[model samples]
Target: MNQHILNVKRRTSLVTVFTLILSVQLGFIAYSGELKSRVPPDQLQEAQSLKNPYSVTKEFVDKGRILYEGRAFCSVCHGRDGQGLPVGPDYDSSSQPLPTNFTDGAWQTARSDGEIFWILKNGSHGTDMAAFMPQYVSEKEAWQLVTYLRSFQGA
Candidate 1:
């Protein structure tokens, strides 16, 4: 009787662990499926029209890297590789969106440079993403950050 109860307990524990993992994965999938523009409707046109004034040079990328990894602390949430770090179990998808996986080719293609700059300048509302320009970084540095972000594409 003792052996049978132990086996049953083990099976139940395994099932519970598996179910938790499945739920987390399903949440990620559901969020990915519903990916939408973070820009406000009123500023979408202007944000899309904005362009990067700086060139995509190594020096600029290096500057952007410094800001992203240092002052801006983008890597704290976005990950050093720009794939985004894991969210806590308390993450609420309805209000707080996940950090963008910059390594995703599809995502890189979908997000325009202007849109990215706009995000940096205005921040994405209802999310953890905060505006960094003018406070953490200048407009030029933001453009450089965009260039560095592009390097993460297909990575």
Candidate 2:
């Protein structure tokens, strides 16, 4: 009886959390009629203030491409071209928001170089995004990916 009660309580708590998250997402859309970014306001501001540390060149793009495709395997989730949509839980088990669409000029424009780098370093919370710490990829490599991802704009 105690075990059953505990299970019920746990399930109820999970449902409540899920409902709250869904409600907030719905509220954001209804209020603005715009897709709400998963990132928090403080993170957004901090990311916006950052600047790219390196000048983008073909060599840098190539290097980034290697990391993004190779060890990183970002392509698996983000796609080869790096364009994806948030496939909800029905389609994907994780139900994390979609991978970023780098080709979207307006979307890319809204994010700062620092923001991208920060995401790469720290990863976004409340989502499936995993941080690529310096142990996995150096700061320079992360910056290279930013350059490569930005290149998708206008293409």
Candidate 3:
């Protein structure tokens, strides 16, 4: 082959390899957490049955608000108001088919405090809401956010 043709072929090969690698990376990133909820029915029910020892006081709610917006990084997707925000199906998204609106009075009433706590601790599968483990957010703090979410229902 002419030298020019050989160079062109080499460049084409490199481009093909790069494209393949990029596609694979994007695919892996997309499927990394393509689950909706890993919590089993029984386990979820069990978590739902649990309760928060801390009372829903203003102080507790305020602390939770701080954590939600700051340390826990909940507000980015869930919004400062605790209503779900619409983000793409990309990494760090709530996988919120819709912004999981906590502001909904009926939805708020439907879910239990324990259920909320469980989701926070274990994380909702397939969603960008990763598990806020004790290492990241302590058990007490998790409950505090739950308290805030519950109390913030009407607003």
Candidate 4:
């Protein structure tokens, strides 16, 4: 009878330890917010603006070039002209999942800046486009890329 009670106590202790470890891991995931998909709506709108708030002289297109070449490496797949390369899907190809042709005026006109920013940060999953961008890019930088992409519209 004593042996049976001791075995039950040992099993209880092991379960308690396992529960504690699982709770800690779950708490960490909740604190980090890794499970969330979209940015807050207010922040998304502010980040979507096409003009720089700091200075009248700086445009988003100009800043976007710096980001494209430097941090984002956007040119690797999209090309300098924003006419996407074969590294990903061709925007114009019938056989491929059409990427957004930055050069398409009608398409650009239809999309809001917020929509574009969402795509950039979240990426289109299940496609060749792995989320190439990180949320670490400043809101200013995101707007800049928006402007730069607009430049290709109707070009």
Predicted structure with the largest TM-score when compared to the true one: 1
Residue-level lDDT tens digits of model 2 in 47-99: 66778768888999999999888998788778778786456557664344567
TM-score: the better of candidates 1 and 2: 1
lDDT of 4 at 26: 88
Name the lDDT of candidate 1.
0.87
lDDT of 3 by residue, 18-116 (tens): 999999998886654333234667697687779888777889888988898898888787788767776555744443444467787866766788877
Off by over 4 Å in 1: 1-34
Query: What are the lDDT figures for the candidates, one per model?
Result: 0.87, 0.78, 0.76, 0.65
How well is each residue in 66-139 modelled by candidate 4, as lDDT tens digits?
Answer: 88767787777677777766544445443344445567666676666666676676675545554545654766
Backbone clashes, candidate 2: 1
At residue 70, candidate 1 shows an lDDT of 90
- Runs of candidate 4 exceeding 4 Å displacement: 1-59, 86-98, 132-136
The reply for model 3, stretches above 4 Å from the true place, is: 1-39, 87-96
Model 3 residue 13 lDDT score: 100
Sorted on lDDT, highest at the top, how do the candidates line up? 1, 2, 3, 4
RMSD of each: 10.1, 10.1, 10.9, 12.5
By lDDT, the better pick of 2 and 3 is: 2
Where is the poorest 10-residue window by lDDT in model 1?
29-38
Give me the displacement of residue 45 in model 3, in angstroms: 2.9
